[model samples]
Every structure is written in C-alpha cells, then in structure tokens.
Target chain A: MDGLKKHIEEITPITNEEFDYIKTFFKEKKVKKHQYLLQDGDKVTSEYWIVKGIFRAFHIDKDGKEHILQFALENWWFSDYNAFFSQKESNINIVCMDDAEVLCLTLSGREQLASEFHKMEHFFRMKLTSGYSAQQRRIISLLSNNPKKRYEEFASLYPNIMQKIPKKYIAEYLGVSRETLSRLYSTTSRD
Target chain B: MDGLKKHIEEITPITNEEFDYIKTFFKEKKVKKHQYLLQDGDKVTSEYWIVKGIFRAFHIDKDGKEHILQFALENWWFSDYNAFFSQKESNINIVCMDDAEVLCLTLSGREQLASEFHKMEHFFRMKLTSGYSAQQRRIISLLSNNPKKRYEEFASLYPNIMQKIPKKYIAEYLGVSRETLSRLYSTTSRD
Candidate 1:
C-alpha cells in the first residue's frame, strides 16, 4: 500500500476523495512463481502494478521461443499494453518469476478515473510520453549497438535483472543469439 | 499550409490565434535527395512534417549497414524523437530519400504549444498513444511473423509507402535481407 501510494504521488497528487474512488476499482492479487497473470490471446482488460516480487511480459516467436519484452519488479507496472489500450486480444504473456503481489486496475476503471480527474489524465499522458521515448531508445540501441555493448548496458541498467533472469532471455530481448551472448560474456569476463 | 491545417484539424480543432502561433514556429525547407535533416551525434532541435517526397530515420549498425527505423511521406512527421524530447544528441539520422519539402518545428515551439493550448496537448497525446501502440505491434510482428508475412502486412497497411520506397529499405525496416525480400515479392506477385 505504501508503494502504491508513492507511485501514485509520483504521478499526481491524488485528493483523498479521488483516491477513495480509485481505490474501489483496484483489487490486490498474489501470484506464485511460474503462474501466469496473462496468456497469449486473452483479452487484456486490466493493468497490474507490482507490489512485490518479479514478473516478466514476453511473446513467443514463430519458432515458439519466448522473447522477453519487459521485466517488472516492485513499484513497476506490467501488462500487454497493446491489448490493454487497443482492446485487442493479447499477443504477449505475463508470468510471475517469483511469488508476487500486484494491484490491478481494469480498463474501464482507468477510463473512469481519467474522465473524473484531469490531473490523472495528465499523469497518464506523461507516463506514455516517457514510455514511448524509452521504446524509441531501445530501437536505436538495437540498430546502433553491437551485442557486446548492449549486454554491458543491460547489465548496468538493470543489475538485479541479470541475476534473476536467464542469459538466453536477455539475448532474445537484445535480438542476439544465445551463442553470441555466451561468447560476449566469455570475452568480457576475460577482459 | 493546407496539409498542415488538415493534419491539425484531424487531431483537434484549433482557433485562428492558436493556428497563427503554430504557423509562426514552422519554417518550410527543401532538402535534396540523400541530404540529412539530422545526423547521429548532432543535437535534434526540430521535427519535420513531410509535405512532398520521402524521408527516413535510420541508424548505422556496427557492420556499417543501415537499418531503417521509420519512413515519412506526405503528411507524416519525422524526427530523432529520443533526442528531440530529451534534449540530447541524436543517435538516429533523418535523411531525405528524395527531393523533399518539409515543415519544421523546434522543441521550444512544441513545448509552447503544449503549455498554451490544452487541445494541442490532447492532440499530441493521442498521437503518442497511437504511435506507441503501432511500435508495440511492430515488435510483435517482428517476433512472430516471417519475412514474407511481414512484407505482405506492411504493403497492405501502407500501400503508398510500398510504391514510394525501394524494396531494400523496406527489407531493412523489417530486419530481413534484400534477397529474402525479393523472394517474398516474387511469391506475392505470383499470388
């Protein structure tokens, strides 16, 4: 609850009345490791904010290999964003990497909140802007950086993530082969 | 100016005063084929809306190969978005694919518009949402779809783009080799 309060405060100052209204829409859920919050083809009706533990959102490639798109830890949010916003069936699956607690908000609830609070709308808009900019940076990194540099940057950017996830998953996210990642790691270790 | 008016109207209604303020900030510029609107390491102060011909945003890989990140045609906008928003040096390059005419807006001008006109901010927010959704879809497509299917979908989605740009550039954007694209084109042509 403290984490949720802090997250909300970072976005906008929520009035107690507005906070109460928003609170009615959110339900807390606990998920065990390997349990799925969402699966491909599901209608993504809710977005989840992490209260505890680790979660990942990933897609299966044509060869049925999982490509991790995002890893969410405490105070972060995770969802099939494309499906949630577009009202389309999800192409991504979200699974808990460890025992987790999450706060969930349904799409309708979010829309209601936005309509009721202009400040909330502004907060969401800012969030989307930063998210969009980050995505743009990811694309540029994919284009400009070699696998080695990307791996180094990844480790530096999310030091905890490297310890929690497999190297293969990181390779997939970086658009490199596991073999390449292994070679890079060996070379870096030697250096 | 007419295209700009139409583009803005499609997003939101702007008053004469608001329109005048926006118009004052934009300067029309003509770029020769293969010329750059922005280059890597340069500060990206402005974004351009294409009025004629074609422009592309790309990055050079370690192997010195170009990867097309996006293309802009008539009525479309192009920028080193990461640089524009963050006020950092650009990692992406914006190059003219053909003799091009564009209307440009600086970062300060855009901020002014957002601060002065709530409608303008709403319009930009909507654009950002749609763009973010599209990027998510592209990521999914890259992960799930074969080169042939990707090309087919792109052709269907942007028929005008297919006719305007070279196949090689499209192949780069799809993260496929030109030879693979040629094979796909032959199969599609037969069908």
Candidate 2:
C-alpha cells in the first residue's frame, strides 16, 4: 500500500479520505507462480497493479509461439488493456512468473473513480500521457534500431526483467529470434 | 474553415463564435507533393488538420529506409505526437503525399482553449481516448497478426492509403520486406 500511496502522490495530491475512497475499489489477490491471471477469450474486466513478484502478458500465435507484450514487476500496472477498456474478450494471456500479490481494479470501478474525483482524472490522464510517450519511443526504437541495439537498451532499462524472463520471450518482444538474440549476445560479449 | 468547423463539431459541439476564436489561432498552409510539413530535428510546435490531400508521418532509419507510422487523409489530424506533447524536437517526419491544404494550431493555443472551455477539455479527452484505443489495437495487431493479414486489414481500413503509398513503405510499416509483400500481393491476386 505504501508503494501505491507513493506512486499516486508522485502524480497528484490525494487526501486521506480520497485515498480511502480509491482503495475501496481495489481488491487484493495473491497469485502463485505459473498460475494464469488471464487467458485469451476471457473478458479482462480488471486491471492489476503489481505489489510483489513478476507477471507477463503475452499472445500465442497459431503455431503456439508466445510473444510477450509486457512484463509487470512491483509498482507497475498490467492488464490486457485493449479488452479491459473496450469491453471485449481478451486476445492476450497474463501469467504469473513468480508468486505475486496484486491490487486489482475493475473497469467500472476506475470509471466511477474518474467521475467522482477530478484529481483522479488528472492523475490518470497524466499516466496515459506518459504511457503514450513511452510507447511512441518504443515504436521508434523498433523501427530505427537494430536488434542488437534494442537488446542492449532493453537490458539496461529493465535489468531485473532481463535476468528474470526467458531469452526467447525477450527476442519475441524485440521482434527477433532466439538464434539472432544468441548471436547478438555473443557479439556484445566480444566487445 | 468549413473543414475545421466539421472536424470540431464531430468531436464536440462548439458554437460559431467559439469556432471563430479557435480559427484565429490556426495558420492555413498549402503543401506541395513530397514536401515536408515537419522533419527530423525540427521542433514540432503545432498539430495539423488536413483540409485536403494526404500526409504521412514516418521515420528514416540509419540505413535511410523509411518506415511509415501513420497516414492522414482529409479531415484527419497529423503531427509528430511524441514531439508535440513532450515539447521535444521530432525524430519523425511529416511529408505531404499530394498537394495538401492544412490548418495548424500551436500547443499554447490548444492549451488556452482547454483552459477557457470545459467542453473543449472533455472533447480533447474523448479524442485522446479513441486515439489511445486505436493505438492499442494497432499494437495488438502488430504482435498477433501475420504480415498478409495485417496488409489485408490495413487495405480494408485505409484503402486510399494502400492506393497512394508505395509498396515498400507499406512493407516497412508491416515490418515485412518488399519481396515478402510482393509475394503476398501475388498470392492474394491468385486467390
């Protein structure tokens, strides 16, 4: 709860009463390693905030190859954002990588919070702006940078993530292959 | 100005007086084919609303290969969005695909409108939500769909874009090669 408090405070000032109101909408849940938080075809009605451990949202292709879209560690929020917001069935699956604790808020609850609190709306808008900005950077990086450079950047930016996730998942996220990633890793080692 | 009126009305109801006030801040410009409205290293201070013709936002890689990010036709708005909101120099280039007419509005002008009009802020939020939703779809499509499916989907969504842009640019946008796109086109024709 301290992490959630700190994150919200960083964006906007929230009164104790306001925080209490907001907190009521979020339900705490514990998930075990290798357990599924969400699976394809399920409706993603809720967004989860990581309080501890790791979780990944991924899509499996026709050939059953998994492409990791996002990895959420402590203090980060994760959801099948498309399905959650659009009220559609999820096309992605979210799996816990480690035993995890999460604070989950339903879409309706979030909307209620936004309508009831102007500052909450501002906080969310700010979050969306920052999310979009980072996504814009990622898109550019994907288009402009080579696989090696992208791998290096990713390692530096999310060092813990790099250590935790499988190499294959990283390759898929970077739009490369396991063989290619291995070659790049060896090339970087030589340097 | 009729185009601007229609565009704003579609987003939110604004009176003629409010429209006129908004109109004063916009500078109308005509761009010749292949000319740039913006380029890499330039500061993106304004967002452009297309009155006529087509525009593309793209980034050129180190190898000087162009990757198309988006296409804007008449009634659509275009900008180096990452640069526009962040007050940063743009890495993306906005090029006119045909002789184009556009009305450009500065960030400050938009901010002023939002401050003065509550409706305008609500309107902007609605637009942002839809834009974010579309972006989420694109990201999911990129990760989940094959190149052929992506091409078909893009064609159906923006048929005009498919007709106007070069195949290579489409290929780059799909993260496919020119050769692969050629193969896909032939296969589709045969079917």
Candidate 3:
C-alpha cells in the first residue's frame, strides 16, 4: 500500500486523504507460481497492479501455439484490457510465473476515482500516453527484419524482464526463432 | 471547427466558451495527397486530428521496403506518438493519401487543456483507452498465423478504411502478400 502511494505520487502528489480514499478501491490478493490469473472466455473485471511477481499474458492458437502479448513484472499493470474496459470475454490468458501479490481495481472503481478526482484522470492519461508510445515502438520492431536489432532492443528496454523471462519466451515475444535467439545471445555476449 | 467540437462533445458536453478556448489550441492545416506530413528523422511536435482525408503512417526498412504502421482517416488521430510524447526524432513517416484537413495540437497545448479543463482530460483519456485497445488487437492479429483471418479482421474492423485504401497498402499493413490480398478481396466481394 505504501508502494502504491509512492507509485501514484511519482505521477501526481496525492495527500493522505486522497490516498486513503483511493486505496480502498483496490483490494490486494496473493497469487501462487504457475497459477492461472485469467483464461480465455473469462469475463475480465479487475485490472491487476503487480506488487511483486512476474506473469505472461498470451493468446493460444488452434494448434496450441502461444503468442506472447506482454509480460508483467513488479510495478506493471496487466489484464485483458479490452475485456476489462468493454466487459467482454477474454481472448487471452494470463498465468503467473512467480509467486506474487497484486492489487486489483474494478472498472467501476477506476471510473469512480477518475470522475471524482481530476488528478487521477491526469495520471491515467499520462500512463496511457506512455503505453501508446511503447506499442508504436513494438509495432515498428515487429515489422523490422533485423533480428539482432530486435533482440538488442528487447534487452535494452527491459533488462529486468529479459533477465527474468526465459529465452524461449523472449524469442516468442520477439517473433524470432529460438535458434536465431541463441545465436544472437552468444554474439551479443562475445561483443 | 464544428466537427472538432462535435467530436469532443460526443464524450463530454462543453459550453460555447469552453469550445472556443479549446479550439484555439488547435491550428487547422490543409494536406495535399502524397504530401509528407511527417518524415523519418524529423522532430515530431504535434499530433494531427483528421477533419477530412486519408493518410498512412509507415516505416522504411534497410532493404528499402515500406511497412505500413497505421492509416488515419477522418476523426482519427495519427502521429509518431513515441516521438511526439518524448520530444524525440521520428522514425516513422505520415503521408497524406488523399487531400485532407487536420487540426494540429502540440504537446504543450494538449497538457494545457487537460490541466485547464477536467472534461478535456477525460476526453483525451477515453481516446487513449480506445487507441490502446485498438493497438492491442492489431498486435494480436500480427502475431496470428492465419493471413485470411487477419485480412477478414481488418476488413471487419475498418471497412471504410479498407474501401478507401488501395490493395497494395492494405497488403503491406496486414503483412500479407499483395496476391493473397487480391484473392481475399475478390472472394469477399463475390460472397
């Protein structure tokens, strides 16, 4: 909870009263390693804010091949946002990679805070701005043909995530072959 | 512009006074077809809100192949958002596909309006939410192995843009071969 206050304060200063009210909207939960947080066809309601742990959000194809959409680590937020926002069934699955605790906020709760507090709205807007920017960069990288550049980018932008996530998952996220990733990793180490 | 005012009011209603003040932050510009609104290595300062027209934002690869990132149509906003938000040099290019009119708003102006009016902040936040959701869907489609499914999804989501944009550009955007797109287009039309 103190960390939540610190995180919110990083974007906008919220006093004791505001923090108290805001914190009530979020309920904390513990998650075990390899547990399923969400699954396909589930009605997504709450968006999770990671307090500690790692998780993968992915979509599985008919052939059971998984496509990694994103990874959530400490201080990151994750959910099937489209489902959460529109109150639709989830098309993606989120599974925990490590034992963790997360703070959950329902859509109604999120809206209540935003509508009641102008600063909360600003904070969400700023966060989305950065998220939007990151997606644009990822799209560009996905379109690029340079495998080495892509690997280097992932390593540079998310050193912590890179270290935590396995090479196979990293390759899947980068749209690169496992063999190619291994070669790139060895090459990068030599360099 | 009444269109801009209407667009904003669709989410939140505002008075004549507020609209007048908000409109001043945006400057309208006429764009000619084939004109470059933004180019690689350029400094991005503003995001454009299309009043009328069609445009494609893309990246050029080392092999000199162009990859379409997104298409902007009437009421859509487009820019190298990563650059726009970070005040960095742009790696993407936004070119007008049809003669169009757009309202430009700088980052400073955007922040000013958000701070000055709570409604504006909510409006932008809502816009970003939709934008983020759209990008997530796009990323999923890109990762999917079924080209036909990808083509079908695009056609369904942006039927208007599909009708307006040429087959070549649509093919590039979906990362499918031009020949495959033509076959899909013909198959859909004959249905």
Candidate 4:
C-alpha cells in the first residue's frame, strides 16, 4: 500500500522491487469498532502497522481498573512487543476504538525481512529508537506529580491525538481524574 | 571489549573480524563515583555500555526533587536516549554511583556500524526491543498504586540492581517514598 511505502520510506528509501517483496510479508486485516485486535493471554504472533483507525492498548489491574498503556493511530505500529519478541502470552489487550484496517507481520516474517535487507533492518532500528525515546518521555511524565504539566505536555506533543481521543481516555492516559482533566482542558483552551 | 562482544553475541552471533571492527567505533571512558557523565542542558552525543560500574540517570524537577529514570549496571546500556538519538540537549543527568568504566559510541559511529553490518543493525534493534518492553513494564508499575506490588516486581525483575542501588533511589524509581521502600525491603528480606 502507498501508506506502507510512505511509512517505510520515512526512515529508508527502497527500490520498487524491494517494496514489492517487503509488501508480501504483511497480510491485511480489518476490524470493527469495539472489536478486540488482541486480548490478554493470547500468543502475540504478529506486530501490526495501522493503515486506518485508532486503537488502545491497556492492562486491567486486579481491582478491575483499566490503565491505558498507549494509543496507535494511522501509520503507527502497535503490538504487545514484549510478548511478540519473547513469544510469550500478552499481558495487555488491544481493542479497536474505531473501525480499522491493519497490516500484520509475524515474528518470523519480521526477522526474515530484517536479515534479508539491510535497509529494512535500518528502518526497524530507527523506528525502535523513536519508540524507546517516547517510552523514556512517558516514564519521566509518570514520575512527575503535576497533572496540569502532564496535560500540557501531552497536548503539545500530540495535538492530533488529543483532538481524536475521548476526554475520559485522555484522563486515564494522564493518570488524572475526569474532573481535573476537564478543568485543565478549560484552562488550556483559554490560554 | 570481551564484554561488548558477548553483549552483541547475546542477540546475534558475529565473527571475530566483525566484532573487532565493531569495537573500534567505541571509546572507553572512566568515571568516579558521584561524577556526572552527563548533565542537564549538555549535548547528548554518545550512548554508553557499562563495563564495570553502576550509574543513575535522573531528572531534577522544579521543586528540586530527584526522579530516577533508570539505573545502569555492568553490561547494561545507558543513555539519555531521547537526547542521544535526537542530538538534543539532555533534560536529565547520568551520574556514576560507583567508579566505573564504560564504552561510548557516538550517533554517527552507531549509525555507521548498523549500516555497515546487518548483524549490528539486528543487534541494536533487539536491544531496543528489550528496552522498550522494560519501559512498558515500568509504565504499568508506575500506574499501579500498590507500592508493595511495585517493589516486588522491581526486585524480581532486577535482583542485581536491587542489591546494588541505594534504597532511596529505588524508592524514587518506584515513585514511592523512602519510608515505604524501607518497609518493603524489611518485609521482602523476612519473606
């Protein structure tokens, strides 16, 4: 797909022949709103690249409280990467928030592609580099106690995601209460 | 250098010749205890692989509270990766907890090695994969309000680090108070 091409090319340029070959490793899947792409305890065999739609990955604690881990939008990659790489059962669930289409690559296929192509490996490494940086930022954010600062940083960093994701989910992601989020939102809008 | 070779081999096996070539990119640096390897606002130019030391990477907030981002022990990689990869000024500081030796590789050197050898690219990707998963686990721990569970999980996952790091820093890492960490340690030891 053109989206896949654009996404891959954002990190490394590929020949038309290479693109055609790389595309073969991915299979397309579709899901409807409220449907689950992955559930806890399932073997995470594949990592996905979103072609369209929004999805949330979360863990439900023992007390039945949902802790949002991350959200993926179009062109973003998503997976229980811990399970995917270790070939273990997933500890989290990913559900489609909007009707979606995704391209999936199994673990073996991913490894094969990376080994067979240097640029592909470069592309994956660069993507992981960015993902690692984001996680580090998230850790710093979670460590900070100021919810308003967290809200402002989240909005500034992901204005598009802020607009697209529901306020309640955003509140969960920020580890803030709905009332606090609403207040922050009102004040942010005023500023 | 043997440690570096072994570290890379843990992910992907490499020939002696390749390992030698790869080792050339890295330069060794020694740091004394309490010495800052990197400071806030300093340009992050290199990522370090610990040879023989413990180090703490942390951010100091406006209220002058230290929030431990991570700890690096022997054979572990450490960096303000967000700043290192982005080539930006660091927002955090990395200080030696023990007199230590580390191998430092610049961004250009790292990129060159990855491009020059597919195995090196695989090596980097695999390391990032593990790092990303650890960050996800940390995010989950941070979101969970139960300090006992957090301490137990951290101790189980990093027993060596638990022994090597000071209790106060561990408390900061868990986002729990030192008093709570002391109780957890006493309970954990009794158990």
Top candidate when judged by DockQ against the true structure: 4
Which parts of model 3 are misplaced by more than 4 Å?
A189-191, B186-191
Positional deviation of B141 in candidate 4, in angstroms? 0.8
Please give, for residues B1-191, the per-residue lDDT of candidate 3 as tens digits: 99999999999999999998899999989999999999999999999999999999999978888988888889987789999999999998999999999999999999999999999999999999998888887777777676776787787667767669888899888788888988888887788
At residue A178, give the lDDT of candidate 3.
Answer: 91
lDDT of 2 by residue, B1-191 (tens): 97787877886788888888878988999999999999999998998888998888889878987877777888776688778988889998988889989988898887677656755655565556656665655665666667876777567557656577787778877888899888887887687
The TM-score between candidate 4 and the true structure equals 0.94
Find the candidate with the highest TM-score and give its number: 3
lDDT measured at residue A131 in model 1 versus the true structure, 0 to 100: 74
What candidate 4 gets wrong by more than 4 Å, as runs, is A186-191, B186-191
Clashes of 1: 0
What stretches of model 1 exceed 4 Å from their correct place?
A175-191, B177-179, B186-191
Candidate 4 chain A weakest lDDT stretch, 10 residues: A153-162
Give every collision pair in model 4.
none
Interface RMSD of 3: 0.8
Clashes of 4: 0
